[model samples]
Target: MLSQFKTPLLLLSSLALCACSAVTQLSSTQSDATITIKEGKHSGNPRSETLKTTSFGNYEFKVEQPQGKVLYGVLPLKFNGGYLAADILFFAPAAFFNLREVYPYYEFDTEKGVVRYKNKPQDSWLEYAPLAAESERAKAYFNAKP
Candidate 1:
């Protein structure tokens, strides 16, 4: 009976370990798409660039910095919350975004240069960037037009 009990215990422990590993992989696997701008042509370096990646891909604008040399910027589209949260954070720069009324995007500090946008971050996996946000642009454009 004791040997039988030991075998069962070992099997149970193995299952528990597998479950824990699966959960760890699930959380760790979650990653967002990065949007970066290529200046001249270097390749790789420190300071990772970023950009919000939502279900609805709507990033397609060149942000013109008000001051400074005008380096690129990116927003970490993937975070605790995507799209909605990312948008609220990404396009926080309503100044330049104001002009791109159709998209209504943002720009936050990141490791690499800046990432520009012209639409709100969406939460749809199918939707992609290079797309236009003409509808949203008409609405929010005037609210904070640049």
Candidate 2:
């Protein structure tokens, strides 16, 4: 009886793994900001993407405002509690994979001209406080004479 159920269970797990990617929506208050993903595996438009849940890496993104103010940051990803629970209940091996849930909001400090984002999945959103030298570098990058 146990052997009879093994094949079906394997098939189910395979299907679940194949459909593990999550659809994430990226949004910012600056409607004119151009979003560019510098890294990570994702598909779809800049405003939305299907992100791989099992991938472990930083998704570096740059938000360039219409006025040429550019801010760089990483998109946040957290572990999905529901998926974790399911993995634990069904296949213990799947729990070893890094299954992440993407947060839909991207916060920006328009005044400071820095993009704010979480450094880790469980940490609070980071605030950008650039040093004088860093600020100068940013200014130089944006205002360089062509």
Candidate 3:
């Protein structure tokens, strides 16, 4: 009886893996990247808000203070060839969902006094450039009042 269900379960698991679009940029051997407050009163502390990566290669984070002020940012991600190759070889359809695998690096801009996210891909700096805090969602979050 147990064996009767085993094959179906295995098939389902494989299908789910094949459907998984966003392969985490952090490799199985590495730890998940963390986001911390770069400056301000909370500087150097781990941010309590949640950070999530989209299937299209974007990092989104939001922090809301007790006073109702919201601070948020979205960092664009760059494609990783190594992961792309692995995904193609293992999960073909999932490989086409997204090519981006990591967020390279991020820094606190002393001049701008804001955190800047970056990625240095070969030849093209467009995907590697820093992202600004002008996104509509971020704007709304900041403008929202309690």
Top TM-score hit: 2
What ranking emerges by TM-score with the best candidate at the front?
Answer: 2, 3, 1
- For model 3, residues 1-146, the per-residue Cα lDDT tens digits are 99999997897687555444332211111122233221212222232222222246454433433344444565455555655675676566656555653344444322232444444434332322234544455545435634
TM-score of each: 0.19, 0.54, 0.40
Model 1 segments beyond 4 Å from truth? Answer: 23-146
Tell me the spans in candidate 2 whose CA falls farther than 4 Å from its real position.
1-19, 38-46, 107-146
Number of clashes recorded per candidate: 20, 0, 1
* lDDT, model 3, position 77: 52
Candidate closest to the true structure, highest lDDT? 2
Better of 1 and 2 by lDDT: 2
The lDDT per prediction is: 0.29, 0.58, 0.41
lDDT of 2 by residue, 26-62 (tens): 5455776666553334322236666566545555555
Rank all candidate structures by their lDDT, best first, as comma-separated numbers. Answer: 2, 3, 1
Off by over 4 Å in 3: 1-54, 62-71, 96-98, 109-114, 117-134, 141-146
Who is ahead in lDDT, 1 or 3?
A: 3
